[model samples]
Target chain A: MTVKVQREDFDVGAELAAMTRGKTSIGGVTLFVGLVRDMAGGESVSAMTLEHYPGMTEKQLEAIEAEARARWPLDDALIIHRYGRLEPGDQIVLVATASAHREAAFESCHFLIDWLKTKAPFWKLEATPEGERWVEAKDSDDAAAARWANQDGDQKG
Target chain B: MKVLYFAWLRTKIGVAAETVDLPPEVKDVGGLVEWLKTRSPKHAEALANSKVVKVAVNQEHVPYDHPLSPGDEVALFPPVTGG
Candidate 1:
């Protein structure tokens, strides 16, 4: 298990390679990368500043990763989330899960990102043409996380 | 106890964190908010709506009714929009 919150960017290929260096037992790997969008709510965004609680962010992420591990037969899992100011097209987060099969890898990867959206303590402030505005938590994000909670038995890997 | 604010709450409150000596009447997270509101108009305004403010006790998310200890670290902020 690996979890990190940093101000610098990350390399996806390097991270994936390091995660599965000598793990021949792993059959499949699933990854999700969250990027800073140039537009939000139909407005053009110039920059996005990510703010997070220093200690609590790592604690919450660790808890989220642990939950995914407990629910799946994952050989390894990695969560790298970046903080501080970022412009459009910058990578904001990466969630990768490796398992012996594709199903566990795919589902656990999705679960990690979905849970992170609602449970994590980071907030985004987008600088739009109008002004700097804080992004609001979407109901769709809550619904996304809720589906996993609803189908707990079927999704267990 | 150390009380922290973040995001817009930090901006509105004009300070990131502060140490406060709680009165005897403050025993839970809800009571802490009520007591903190009296610190200044900014505190009262930022924490006016209890429904919008999220609380964490000692780096863990908890409900407003969660009990508080003498040295517990408390944080207040808006709903998380992180990815």
Candidate 2:
């Protein structure tokens, strides 16, 4: 497991390669990359500044990753989230999960992102033409995260 | 105890962090927030919309009523909008 919160950009290819190396049993890898959108609330975003608690951000992310690992048969997992100022079209976060089967890899990867959306300690402040505004958490994200609380029989959501 | 602010809260409160002695009545997160508002007008304005504000104790996400100890690290900010 690898979790990092940094101000610098990351190389997805390098990370994925490192995660897969020396793991001969791995047959599948699922990865997700999050990008800053150019438009929010019908306004064009000039840039976005992500703020996070220095010590708390990593702790929260590690807990999220640990939860995903416990819920699946994942061979490896990695999450890298970038903080600080970023413009639209910039990569913001990455999540990758590896397992012997595609089912475990895909489900665990999906779970990591869903949990990170609401549980993580990062906040976004966007700069637009009108001025700067703190991004509000959408009800849709809460709803999406709630789906996991309800277990689907023996398998975890 | 250390009370930290972030994002707009930092700007409104006019400081990133400060130390405060927890009064006996300030037993929980809710009580702490209520007491913090009395510190200054800026705090009152920033915490006016308490419903929208989020709190974390010792780096973990918690509800408003979560208990607090004397040395715990508490943070105040808006709801997380991160991906």
Candidate 3:
């Protein structure tokens, strides 16, 4: 497993290739990338800035990825998140998971993203036409992460 | 002890971080927030809506009742909105 927090953009293709170069047992790799949205809270966002508690951010992300590993039988996992100023359409985060089967890879990827959304220490500020405003955490997100609270063991794999 | 603010809280509070001596009466995160509000009007405005402000002790999310120590690091901010 790997976790990276960087300001520079990453080559997803190269990252995936390097991750699965010699892993013949891996049957599936699931990847998800988050981007800066132009529209947010019904306003037109011109630019955005991501802020994070540097030391805590990495620790939290590693913990989140570890949780996904514990829940699924996975071969490898990676999480990349960016910080600093970004324009619309900029890549913000990426999650890649590999497994012998697709179910574990898919579900674990989804779980990692969900947990990262609420558990991570990163915050966002969007430069809207009205002005800059801090993004609020949606209750729906907390509810989404809460679904795993009762999950005890591997039910889908 | 050190108190760090992030995002809008930093903007509202007009500072990123500050060092302060822990008061004897302040035993937990909630008490710290209450005492911090007295430091300035900006702090009061930023922390007025306690429901929206979140706190972390030593970089770990904790409830308001979480205990504090003399050398601990405390961060105040809004809920996380990232993926």
Candidate 4:
């Protein structure tokens, strides 16, 4: 597993290739890319500044990835999150997973992204015409993470 | 102790960072918040609704009962909204 927080842009194609390298057993690769949306929660977002607890952010992401690996037969996983100022059309995050079968790769990839959205430490300050405001946490994110909780499974420490 | 504020909490508090000496009895984040409330009316008002304020110790998300030390760094912010 690999987790990174950087200011430079990442190429999804390169990252996917890197994770799949030397893995002939892998039959499927799944990925999720999140971009800055122009609007959210009825507010128009012109730009966003992403802030995070520098040290803890990567730790939390590693924990989330470990949990995903424990629950699935994934061969490898990669997470890349960008910080600092970002405007619409800029990529915010990418989650990629590889596995022997499509099912495990797809499910675990989705799980990793969902869990990161809620559990990760990154915060966004949205620049709106009304004024700059912090984006509110969505109930959907909580609900997404809650689905994994119902399994009565332990998260990998 | 150095206190940092982020996200909406920074906006509401009107400052990004500050330094203050915490009382000895304030053993944890919860206690420190209570003491901060008495420092100024704005602090009291900003933290009045604890649901909106998330606390961190040394750049880690910590529980309210997390302990504090003299030189420890503490941060306060709103819940995350990143994807």
- What level of docking quality does candidate 2 show? high
Candidate 4 chain B minimal-lDDT segment of 10 residues: B5-14
TM-score of each: 0.96, 0.95, 0.96, 0.89
Which tens-of-lDDT digit does each residue in A116-143 have in candidate 4?
8877888998899998877788888878
- Kindly list the per-residue Cα lDDT of model 3 for residues B3-83, writing each as its tens digit: 999998999999999999877999999999999999999999999999988998888888899999999999999999887
Q: Rate residue A111 of model 1 by lDDT.
A: 95
lDDT of 1 by residue, A4-29 (tens): 99999999999999999999999999
- For candidate 1, lDDT tens digit of each residue in B34-83? 99999999999999998879999999889889999998999999989998
Supply the TM-score of chain A against the true chain A for every candidate structure.
0.96, 0.95, 0.95, 0.94
RMSD (CA, angstroms), candidate 1:
2.3
What C-alpha lDDT does candidate 1 achieve relative to the native structure? 0.94
| Model 2: colliding residue pairs | none
For model 2 chain A, the run of ten residues with the poorest summed lDDT: A148-157
Interface RMSD of each: 0.6, 0.8, 0.7, 1.5
lDDT (0 to 1) per candidate: 0.94, 0.90, 0.91, 0.86
Candidate 4: residue A131 lDDT (0-100): 89
Docking class of 3: high
Stretches of model 2 off by over 4 angstroms after superposition: A152-157
